[model samples]
Target: MSTNTEARLFSPTTIGAIGVVNRVAMAPLTRSRADMEGVHSELAIEYYRQRATAWLIISEATNISREGRGYAFTPGIYTDEHVASWRRITDAVHEAGGKIVCQLWHVGRMSHVSLQENGAAPVAPSAIQADEQVFLESQTVERPSMPRALETAEIQRLVEDYRNAARRAMEAGFDGVEVHAANCYLLEQFIRDSTNKRTDQYGGPVENRTRLPIEVITAVAEVWGADRVGVRLSPITRAVGDTPLDSDPEGTYFYLAGQLGKLGLAYLHCVEGQTRGDNGAGDFDFKRLHAKFGGKYIANNSYDRQMAIDAAESGHADMVAFGRPFISNPDLVARLRLDAPLAEANRDTFYGGGAGGYTDYLPLADAA
Candidate 1:
């Protein structure tokens, strides 16, 4: 076990304008504990507060607008009421001496009509259906409804939704925001050529295909200076609905990272491989992608303690993000420093639930 002074993971680092106490970050995990109105429940305050030891907490995938939702009980950031609800959670995290950022999300075609407004079809870059399923209000999984191609004119409105969500994140007292452009979501739908078959400015070649995501990021950067914003990307993840990899994962993502780097954003959070699976699932070079960006990198996806320590010591990553571990070990930073055994989280209680597996897990000290 490495002492606090021995582990480079305990060292402080600056992610853009935000100075973190350590290189450990809590990746976004969808708990589906929000109310029907998309407001986070009161239990979330303690849930996040318990994990305050992390250098940064990237909030779960949050909806930017009503049309952005794909799963039930996920939080939204569009309404004033939503802002007020999130403010309390942010206050709790801050009071506990933690920094957090909201992850703006739009599920695109990965939605069911039952979860949509007026049973409307979900919108996507093309009118194609995904091979995935979404969780409905009843906690049952159902196939996604067919989607309609987004009109070129509506593209600007989607950008506006992201901009407005960033504005609301500011109002809610978050330290910063992460644009969720990964995992076959709305942004990724437009980014990958497999799903996007449009002939408009947002389709075809790599340049045109990445237009919408770049524009959305630009709009978000306009609200919170580029230095305070971060973009999350998964170059070859087929996690949701078996979304196929881009025709050229290396070419597409390297180009995208270079473009984002030019915007002077804080950092690029890359899911190294499959979301909850393999870390070396593909042949793409993440180091080259990081080099292409020429900025700080937060390496994620199944990173264990030694891997994280090595990444930090070798300067391969500025920070490392842990997902499921954070759910079972709120004092994960302390455990890592002491080399303590981590508790496993209950898979059944991972989704919509009360305070069972959410916050009942004891810290190392309490467990001892």
Candidate 2:
């Protein structure tokens, strides 16, 4: 007989208008398996379909514009070709009976010259450069030089990028779109102090720093409707030069959360903390963040089966998102439900590779 370790995590639940078979969500993981032009690959299609057991799946970050790209070999949703390629993946997941959301992103100053067009300066709320080294391949390269502050006109254009991407994602057959306003990306850069030091209507003060995010959210909600739109936040993440650590990031997100809660969004994904590496932020107060953001909260960061179950049961998080574990365990949801041991993933084959660790991780019966 099987014990009920998955009682909370595996329980059926609903967030907004989306009905989930369970509360386990698959957080978006950047696999770097796409084509040179950031188009989705067949391998990606298989990888996502294999793990459709989750209540919802947020696809890897897809750059909303060329300048939005921060790495090599990732996918994009800004072009017709990009849309076609992702449609293949979305079609496959739908056939498997799963709901998927595309995470639209813009990297801001955390980009490299190698990833930009003619090495154009990255655009941000201010001219500040995070001045950090980003590891792409074997060697670490200096980030693309600092960017000039985006003009109000340019800021409006970036918002359109998100709007167009959301429209394309829907046309390509996705359930919804999540505006990536976290992880020190472009949106997050504006939300924090270290980066968004501007004197325009879009900068300074809590309300101004939050203007871009709310605008982006409004655009996405308009295109996908509030019911299908969600945003991710990492108030505690100290990526790049972000600062002042929101001694109460919870309060910051609380204000943002309550504002969003009124919009009737499908969900709010809390990155938990900085995810620059496998070992997430060692210092994080998830309970406090959860208290502030009262909607359907999906918590991500080094989660294991029992911890996820406990979080879901205790109401700390409505759902749990697993990243590294899902890399090798395609049947992660099934494994957790059965309390079966999982196959450890091959970190060696993580980025820039074929389908070795991408899709070769076997199911439970095969592992047995």
Candidate 3:
């Protein structure tokens, strides 16, 4: 086990059933490029195939059902058509020697009424309105709609929905599925004390707050097996639609990570440091989580090539996930290895766009 920079960053490793040639991963990114029918296009196939060099590529946060949709043109995995559409993308990645996993998501209170069913209210652990607005095809609106508190029965159904979606993902040819428990979505909304004010067994104490997420994980694991599953958590980020930081983030996530560890997950993706800037947000120690998690850590958020090398060489993370870099640099893994200049990503075309900024970025040779 050489601890040199290249050795640490490029060494092959196994994460559960998936094998990686390097420690570079592609973080799940929402581009809102799916069709109106919630199906991925051929463009998505090429988009993923171009970035196939990543050790693992986590697909964008995909809705599990119509009720789970929070933004326009985001793909879903709950329908037969959706499964078929995703097969093309998965087949392309596999053909290009890549491993990919779909991220199961439910927006919960972070949704707007326009994206809901028949202008219905979104659902959450409680009826609290998130201080966040959702993105629409037309425009980004403010003042997210007030969500209805999910009944105990509906909560059970949501867990079942996750199971079904995982099954569909496997059918769609994904290597596995990653539970979207981070980024102030449905699971995070329940895990955080500030949003979950329920008096039932699914709220109040940390155990209660963690209940829904655990159930969802268990159901998804039952479908994909624990070894093929991964969980993502953002312990300190509060920028997703003004999601508030937890009063006891350290305690809440440590306990959660320890619990997830018991399930034998493939990896735990932790979004640490500042959301958009450097890794100097606060006193939060992601290394402590790596220890408690007792599994491979995929560290994400604002990581450069050197920072990624440092995290792996120091045993802080087994892999580093890059989002924005992958957007502009299709050959990101090669570029990082050679320390080549990365192409600048056009933020304007990041979401709700066509291939102008999606698959149009040239590789190193073309750029040269």
The candidate that achieves the highest TM-score relative to the unseen native structure? 1
Q: Each candidate's lDDT (Cα)?
A: 0.93, 0.80, 0.89
lDDT of 3 at 207: 93
- Please list the residue runs of candidate 3 whose C-alpha ends up more than 4 Å from where it truly belongs after superposition: 1-5
Give Cα distance to truth, residue 91, candidate 2, Å.
1.2
How many steric overlaps are in each model, in order?
Answer: 0, 0, 0
RMSD (Cα, Å) for all candidates, in order, is: 1.3, 2.6, 1.6
| Candidate numbers, best lDDT first, in rank order | 1, 3, 2
Question: For residues 1-368, could you state the per-residue lDDT of candidate 1 as single tens digits?
Answer: 34454787898989999999999999999999999789988899999999988969999999999999999999999999999999999999999998999999999999999989999999999998998789999889999999999999999999999999999999999999999999999999999999999999999999999999999999999999999899999998898978999989999999999999999998999999888887872557999999999999999999888888888888889999999999999999999988789998899999998989898999998988
In terms of lDDT, model 3 sits at: 0.89
Point to the candidate with the largest lDDT.
1
What global local distance difference test value does model 1 have?
0.93
By how many angstroms RMSD does model 2 differ from the true structure? 2.6
1 or 3, which is superior by lDDT? 1
**lDDT per residue, candidate 3, 111-230, as tens digits?**
888888788999998888888567875756667789999998788889888999999999999999899999898999999998898999999999999999999998999998888899
Q: For model 1, how many clashes?
A: 0
Q: Which stretches of candidate 1 lie over 4 Å from their true place?
A: 1-5
- C-alpha positional error of residue 319 in candidate 2 after TM-score superposition, expressed in Å: 1.2
Q: Please provide TM-scores, in order, for all candidate models, with all chains considered together.
A: 0.98, 0.92, 0.97
